[model samples]
Each structure stands twice: as C-alpha cells, then as structure tokens.
Target chain A: MKKDKIINRRDFIQTGIRTGIGAGLGIIGFGLISRSVEGKTIWQLDPAKCVQCGNCATECVLQASAVKCIHVTDMCGYCDLCSGFFRPGALELTTGAENKLCPTGAIVRTYVEEPYFEYRIIEELCNGCGKCVQNCGAFGNGSLQLQVRQDLCVNCNQCAIARSCPAEAYSRVEPETAYLLKGFEELKITD
Target chain B: MQQSIKHIKERYIHLTTIIIGCCIFLFWLFYNPVHNFTEAVPGLDNRPPRSSSLGSEVIIGEHFTFFGNAPDPSLTGRWPNFRGADFDNIAKDNVELIDSWPATGPEIMWEKDLGEGHAGVAIYEGRVYVLDYDERKERDILRCFSLVDGTELWRRGYSVPVKRNHGMSRTIPAVDGEFVLTMGPRCHVMCCDATSGEFLWGMDLVKDQKAEEPLWYTGQCPIIDNGVAVLAIGGNALLMGIDCTTGEIVWQTPNPDSLRMSHSSVVPMTIAGKKMYVYNALGGLCGVSAEESDKGKILWTIKDFTPNVIVPSPVYVGDNRIFVTAGYGAGSALVQINKSGGSFSARTLQIYKPSEGMASEQQTPLFKDGHVFNIQTKDAGTTRNQFVCCNPDDFRNILWTSSTTERFGLGPYIIADDKFYIMNDEGELTIARFSTSTFEVLDKAQVIEGDDSWAPMAIADGRLIFRDSKKMVCVDMRANE
Candidate 1:
C-alpha cells in the first residue's frame, strides 16, 4: 500500500518537530515569567506607622521636602539665641541666611567652641516646613525636630508629606534606633 | 491506480514540509538574540557541577580558611556586602589575634542595644545584619544578630522615622548564599531570606528609575554578581542587573552617560582577564563591562577627578592601580588603568588635597603590605583626625600618624595579627601595630559605652564585630579560649 504511505509521511514529520519545540518553550517561558515579576518589593517605612500627616511635604515628587529638619545635639540648648537660628525680630545677632527661620535656606550656623553654636540642618534644604520646629519650639531649647530623614525618606507607602500634615506631625517609626534626643537632658554637662 | 496517485503525492509533500518546519522553528526561537542571551544571564547556560558531595567536608576555594585553628568559621562572620568582603576593606580570612588587650580590653563579647543608623554590618552565615533607626517603631530595621551571642536574629524592616542628621540609615546588605540583599536609605532594593527572615523581593530604585537619591540617601552598597543583583540605580539606567532568583530585570546599565550614584561601593574589578564593574559616578570614574549581554558597558571614564562629596570606596591597589577619597575638602585620587586595543584608559596618578596627606571621610582606604592605610581629616590645623601611613607612590610623605586624640574619626580599620583594630569617634578601642614606620598603640578599650561609634568593624570567625549609635558589639579575639 505504498508502504502505508511512507509511514504516514513519517508521522507527519515527527509531529512537526514536536510542535516546534513546544512553541519555542512557550515563548521562552512567557519571557521568563514576565521578567521575574517586575521590580519585586523594597519600599520600606514604618516609623512606628507614620501619621505625621504633612503628606511628607505635599506628597513628595521632590520639591525639596524629602522630609527634613533634624538636630538633636543631645536635644540642643547650647543656645546663644537659637530658636533654630532666629527670625522673631532678627534685629542683629549675625549668622545670616537672611535672618534664617528655614523656609528653604536650611540653617547651618557652626562655631561649637566658644559658648557653643553648631546649628546644622541642611537636610537637602528641608521643606518639611515646620518653620524650624516652630522657631525651635519657641525661643530655642527644643533643638529643632521633625524626624523622617531615613536617608531622605522614600519609604513612602502613603506618605505624600504624611498626607498634608497640618500638625498631624507624622508617625510610623522603627528604624532600629529611631532618632529622639530633643535636648539631651538640657544639653548635659552637670558637674 | 498508480499506487493511489503516488500515495497522494507523498501526502501532500509531507504535510507541507511539516508545517513549514514548525513555522521556522517557532520563528527561530522567538527571533533569537542568542536565545535572549541564555534567558538574560542566569548563570549563563546551565552550570551546576561543583558540589562533589561535600568533597572532604568542603571549604572549597578557601576564602580565608579557618577551622581547627579558629580564625575563619565562627558561624560565618560577615562584613557581607560593600567594602567588607572583596569589595576590598579586606577580610579574606585568618585571625588568631590578641597581640594585646587586657587592660579592660577584648573581653566584652556581647552588647546588642543598637538602632540609630549609618547602616553597615552584614556578616552572614551565622547572622548579624544591620540597618537600624527604630525610634519606638518609626521603622527601618533589617537587623538580625547572633554572630555568637549577640542574639536578636530576625528583624526585617519598615516604618522610617528619622531626625538625627549625622545619623540615619546608610545602606549595606548584599549577602549571597541564598539572598539577603537590601539597599534602602532611599533606593529600596530589599531581597531577604538567607535563612528565614523572609521578605523575598523589592525594588524602588528611586521611583522606578526617575533616579536621583543621593545627597545622603542611597549609599550605593548592593552588588551581588553571578546570581545577579548589581544596582547603582541612577536613571536612564546607570546599572540594574536584578534576578538573584527572580527579582528580574537582569540587565539595564544604560545611563546613556548620565551616571550619578556615588556615596561609593560597587567595585568588583578584574582588568586584563576582563570582569570590570568599578564605580564612583556622579560625573567621573566608571568602568562597567562585566561581560557584555549589556548590563553595563562604560569601560572607562575620568572626568577631571570630580568630587563635591564622593565619600570614599574605590581602592583597587596593584594591577593597574586606583584609589579615591573625598570629604568636604575633597582630595585624593590615583587612577592609572590603561588596557589599549580593546579600550580603557584612565590616567591621573596622584592628586592629593586636605594639605597633601591622608584624607578619607568614612572609612575605605587600607591597601596593605605595599602600604596605604588612611584616616586624616580635621581640615587645616595641619591634620588632626590622624592615623595615616601613606606611600602609594607620591600621594606622598606621611608613613605614620595616630598619637590617638583627634576626635571625630569615622570608624573602619580591622586587621588581625598584624594588628590595627582602631575604632574611635568617642567609643574608643584602638590597638595599632602596623609598622613601616610607626602607629603602635597596642591597647585602648572603651568598646561602645555609647556615642557616634561610626559603624564599620566586622572581623570574622574569631569574631570582633562593632557598632554604636546605640549598641552592637562582639569582641572575643580568640587565643585565650
């Protein structure tokens, strides 16, 4: 019978070479399971579950509030008139960035040797805008605060400046040893 | 009938040549790019032979062997990623230590308490990772201790509250054997699960590559290699890689030439035989090429020795040279490289600044035996942060410094036996003894009663780990036990 039609045309050419190697291995396994699953997960931020609402400075897309303002020189009080660097009247008392009250000049003041001065806080030009922790908690001694500098805080899960914090003053923390030294027992030096 | 019309014309030419040879072998295996380069570089193409059933209780390439002598395997001591391990803070193995330590020295062996940030420590095998910053739970942990009694063991991370400027999660994780990556200062990354801490995978390399992060945010540290990982993450794709078991990007490296991720750490290097990677990009020092499927290519770039705030971590010493340093004063550069024909060039043999002596800003100098060891700072009182020991060919004239008392020293210096422990920043610890001219303190102590300990410190097997913004110690130099 013509050799059974050449063995049915050699089993239809071996089932079309095993369906072309199973459709080229299902399109390289669906392009490697869709590139493994895109960018995995690392978004972090739990500073005790953050609620400090300022929406991380208008919900950061970066206009300067990578959530800044941080100074705990042992909760600072090495004061000389540092309500986080002046601006109630600013009539004179030098160390200028325009009578600094941090609107984005980000306080710097350095001196630390003669009756102390060391202000420091350029947290990328802080826009966490608490007005230098409200003039360093009204007339210095509070040592400016508003944490969340987790290296420029991008832990963002819902923090668009803590959802526009009016004074919800953000929360969510757990960064192992989360910063909290607001005036180191009044700048310790008790002999 | 003529054999039934010649068997229906050979069954219609064997079913149209087996359906056009299965549609041209499924369109040449989906338009082949070398079959998508072994599915985008997964160990390249089947390589699983080196197991030999634990040959003689294995210990293979001897990454610093230590078993009965006790200098190498104490639950697997790890400086895990960045500068520790071959990134080059040097710690390939060998300990036996204790040339001195007894005046209240070397017997602490345990401390725990840690949580502020500067994030460094990634020991592995027996645990002891770190990332800190947990003000009550604002979150940023990743912890995991137990290098032998430091305890803790599992932490993972979240939250993110911070406030202290001189303190805040820095970035340094990348372990290997089964994953334990991490990057997060702001670049995210994550990975997890080396034994059970579990997180599995993560990404956010600066909002999916719009990438900028680094005024103090992403301190680089995330290299991996072979199993993939990479990540310098400076948009237009400065470097990506991924897929250390399915995180999956597997090849990005195309900054076109934008660069940007330099607080330092991504070094790898190989040169003449070709492996490459090297880094330090905001405007200068590159090298890429890790073996072309294209994850990175750069090869070489210099850019006038750029520095505005680079933060040390490039040291390659011997075999084409390379050394870099930075801080507010911005000084130190060596370079060299060369290659020719296939491409690579570099140049710039020495630059010096900070008054021309040693000047690093956060540990990453030590080259060893041929001499390099650094730690200078204090800008202009003629060098006060001390602890030098130069001569890498005309970065010139210092040979030795370190009478101790200089203050703010940035942590990192741990060589055992040839001595040199150092740790100052107000937590003290000294020990010195690296001769070529002088630096022989021999004993100091203070092991973290607290105060800016600056991070860096992780000996292995014979154990010594260190840390401070709160706590994380582990002394036990071995020899008396």
Candidate 2:
C-alpha cells in the first residue's frame, strides 16, 4: 500500500510542475499579443513634406517600388492643359509620346466635358519617379502624390526607401492611417 | 615555289574580276537617276491632331463641383449687395459690437484659403458668396460657404483663361434671398440659386453685348434691384436691366457717345427729386432713369468731371451736387445738376487738384452728416494717404485728417457700430471712432498675414467677412457681454 501511495505522490508532483510551466507560458503569450495589438505600426509618407527626390523609385527593395502615385480626384482641377500630364513647354498637348510627362506613360488623360480633362494613373507602369507630381504642385492643384501600396509592400523591418528619403517625410504610422493624403481635410466625401 | 606564286596571282586576278562585275551589276540594279520631290499632302502621315485647343470656347457655368454640405445654420443676417442693402458702406443692423478691440483683434471665427484674388464677399441669411478665379484650372468659380464655420458648400465654375492682372478676380457678388449674381474677371455674368448652387443663367457680356473688357479686368459689381439685374454695359449699351426671373433684357439705354466701361460700379442715387442710376463711365458721368415708365433713359450727362481712368463712383450730396474723384493726379470735382421743366443741365460747381482738395485714389468718399470722409491719394501733398474729413458745403474747409503715422493703403473701409473699420495693404485693421471733428483710433491689430487686403468687407449677424489676396477670414465682432 505504501509503495502504491509513494508512486501516486510522485505522479502528482510531476503533474504540478507541468501545470505551473503551462500557466506561466500562457500568461507570457497573452502579454505579448496585447502589446503587439497596441503598438502595431506601418510605414507612411507625408506627401506635404515630400520633395519628389526620385529616391523612392531606386531605393525600394522591390523590383518595382511599392510606392505608387495616388490621385486625389476631389482636389484635381480637371484642367485641359494639365501640368501633370504634359511636359513643360510641350509643343502640343496631346496623347503623343513626345508630349507625355511620365517616362513610362502611366498617366491617362480623359475628357470630362467641353474644357475639363480628368487624369488617372495606371499602377502597373508607375515607377514612382514623381516628375509629374513635382510639376503639378508647382503649376496646378497638387492633387497627385506618392503613397506606399500596402498590398505590394513587403512590410520590411526597415523600409529601404524611408532610409534614403532626403525630405524625411517618412514615419511609422498605424495601419488605419497608412496613407498621409492632402486635401482630405478640406473635402468631404459625398454621393 | 615559282609555280605556286604564279597560281596565287592568277587566283587573285580572277577574284578581282568577279568583284568588279558584281559592283557594276549592283549599281545598275539600285541606282535611280531621276530626282523626285513632291509637296507632302496634309494628313498623309498617321499622326493624330493635337487636342490642346484649350482656353477658347468656354461656355459660362458649364460645370459644377459640389462638396458635402453641412447642416444649414439658422442665422438670419444679410449684407445683400456690394455695399449694404441701403447702398452705403455701413452696417445698419443692430448687432452690438465691442467699443474697442482686445489688442489681439476680434475673435477670429474661421479662416479659409481662397484662390488668389481680391474678390469681395456677399452675405445672405447664413451663406457667404465670393467670385474666385482658380488659377490652376483657368476657371471662374463662384463659391458658397457656410457663414458660421467657413465650410465650402459648393462651387459653380466655368473654364475661362484669365491671365493674372494684379490678381484675377476684382468684383463682389450680389446675393438676394433666392439668387446670387457674380461678374467674373472676364466680364462673364453668372447667376445661381443662392441655397442650392444650381445654375440659373449666365451671360458673357464681352461676347453678347460687345462690352469692352476694362484694363485689369472687370471691377464692376452687379446689383439686383426690384427683381431686375442692372449692369452698366459699356460698348453697345450704356445701361441694361435684365429681368431676374426670365433672363431677358427688359430695358437697355443706347450708347450714343461710345462711352467705354470703367473700373467703377453703378451707384443708385436720388437727386433733384429724381431716382436714377449714376454711373461714372470712362468718357463721362451720366445718370440713367430708374423709373419703370422711363427706365434706362438717359437723364443727364456731364463730361467735365470724366477722368481718363475712373475708379470711384460719383457720390451724390444734397442740393443737386455730385462729388467725383480719381487717382493718378486726376483730382476731385463737384458737379451741380439743375432740372427745370423736364430738362436737365449740369455744370461743374468746383474742381480742384488732388493737392488742393479731398481726393481718393481707389475707394469712393463716404458722405455722411454733411461731411465727406476719404483716404486721400498719394499725391495729396501733405495729406497723402491720410484719412481726411471735409465739409462738402465748403471744399476748402478740412475738418480733420488722420495723423501721418495712421495712413492707409488702397484697402477698403466700412462704418459699423458707429466706428470705422479700415484695413491696410498688409492686413492691419484699425478701428477709429466715427467723428467729424476729430480722429480717435480705438484699437488696431494685424488681422491677416498677406499683402493687398484691398477687397471690401461684409458684415452681418456680428460676423465680419474679409479677405486678403489669398485668404478669407471670418471674425465675430460681437461684444463679449
């Protein structure tokens, strides 16, 4: 009987040790999850501070930079002679390849009305050169800007483009505020 | 070795003979002796035509962009027209204002960024209207904003290329309860629903009426009187009254003398027991009959007081006299009109140079209580840029002039709460007690941060709206109590 009791005691002691270790691990795991939820962040660029330095195109780790041009249509003036679409002092404003401002011909110009023209960007061809963005801000309403496309971004531990940006417009932002857009405060979305 | 050398020479000769024959054959096959040059036919090349025929063929009020609308506020104050409802630069409302400012100026309610221009504001009910020129789009936009918070409600615009001339927009919008009328920098008149921003009608005066575009664009503000919009058109007609509801020309005064449009607006004046629209045209000063039966008929005209460039409208004083002034050393003149037996005649009562009398460069002199008040032009000798008050009965009698340190630029001034709110070129606002005998500055502060704050101000419901070249601000001028 004593022998059986001794065996039972040994088993109880072993189980207790295992339970204590599992409880401690559970507590540690819960704390780590909560901390991550509170401090999760993503890299974002403030367009207002961006100087269009052309580093975003080359410094990105991706083959094609995850950075892409974003069009805030609400702020766009819909101008016929869009400074963003045509090269400075362009002989003729047309869809001809010579007059295009984009090196890769990513911007598409469409007629909206008698004198208004709408501009849109194709993401696949964009190289984040920011040439159009620079000219647009200088001469027209600054509706074109650069942003990191979350789906294309690899979310590296240290963003390559952010390190090389001269303007230091890059900062860590939460996922909800992944984009720093202009004219968003002044304009409210309507039907 | 000798035999081999002979063989090599023979082979070389054979190769050379074959090469010469091939060259001759190639020249015969490819050479063309006839030179052919023909004129190239147009469109033979497959290149597309350029689409850059812009800055032409702009239909006024063709497009509208709407932002989200805020809940309409229930404030009921109105500064309906260019001046006030009474056609005076005075706030007649009973909104009590503080006697002095708080050194930091009045409490600014809101600030908004406007297109670069000096276009003034018009307030009606709880909405504010201004005609702004969008430089990037080359459009004239009539913007409406909430009076309480300065939120842009909506905008109606049309693409018209207006090159920058001392900042583009140069006029104020006139708003009634139902409709708002705006004259663009290029003389495009647009009318829209005041509340809904729906376009009602538009007219290009330069195209339709052949109205000459004045230098530095149109500075004439439209006025709506008794359901009719009155505009002093200068090429084809002297004055035109359009029915506001139907967009039809109700009456037009013929321009017999080829008077050109000026940078001045039409002022409705009652003189010598006659209600008329007084206009200071580039060629002459004339009065048009405003009575319904004889509407748009020329009542009287005098060419003696006409300046090469007139900026200030004729101010009507009592006893059938009108005070006229201009900048650039044109000086000041007073004209007396005598009406007898349904006929009118005018003669200059007194005319003096800017240095000898009270003169204005930009704004019209305010005639109140038998005294005229104006900021003298830069050529007024000792009183240059000084705010001077003079007795209209005697042009030689100067009542008071502001100190030399208290000079003003070409900005605008208005009377509210028995005080004068005047702004300078750099947006420094000064409030002075409105006294004929003396000038007492109650307070002063820098309200805006830019240059050329020359646009006129509008006040209503204790809210004063003013603008610099690119920023518009709203301030609550009510007393704290």
Q: What share of the true interface contacts does each candidate keep?
A: 0.00, 0.00
Q: TM-score, chain B only, every model?
A: 0.33, 0.87
> DockQ scores for all the models shown?
0.01, 0.02
Best-performing candidate as measured by lDDT: 2
Each candidate's interface RMSD, rounded to one decimal?
23.0, 15.3
- Once model 1 is optimally superposed onto the true structure by TM-score, how far is the C-alpha of residue B465 displaced, in angstroms? 6.1
Could you give candidate 2's per-residue lDDT for residues B216-250 as a string of tens digits? 67889999988788998997899999877778999
- lDDT digits (tens) for residues A1-191 of candidate 1: 35544457778889998999999999999989777445433223232234334455666766765666667776675554465676644433455545556656666665553334567876766787566665565333455666666566556566665555555545554454355444444446451
Runs off by more than 4 Å, candidate 1: A1-143, A146-183, A186-191, B1-90, B94-268, B272-283, B286-299, B302-307, B315-342, B345-448, B458-474, B477-481
lDDT, residue B440, candidate 1: 70
Q: State the lDDT of candidate 2 residue by residue for A19-46, as single tens digits.
A: 9999999999999988866778888889
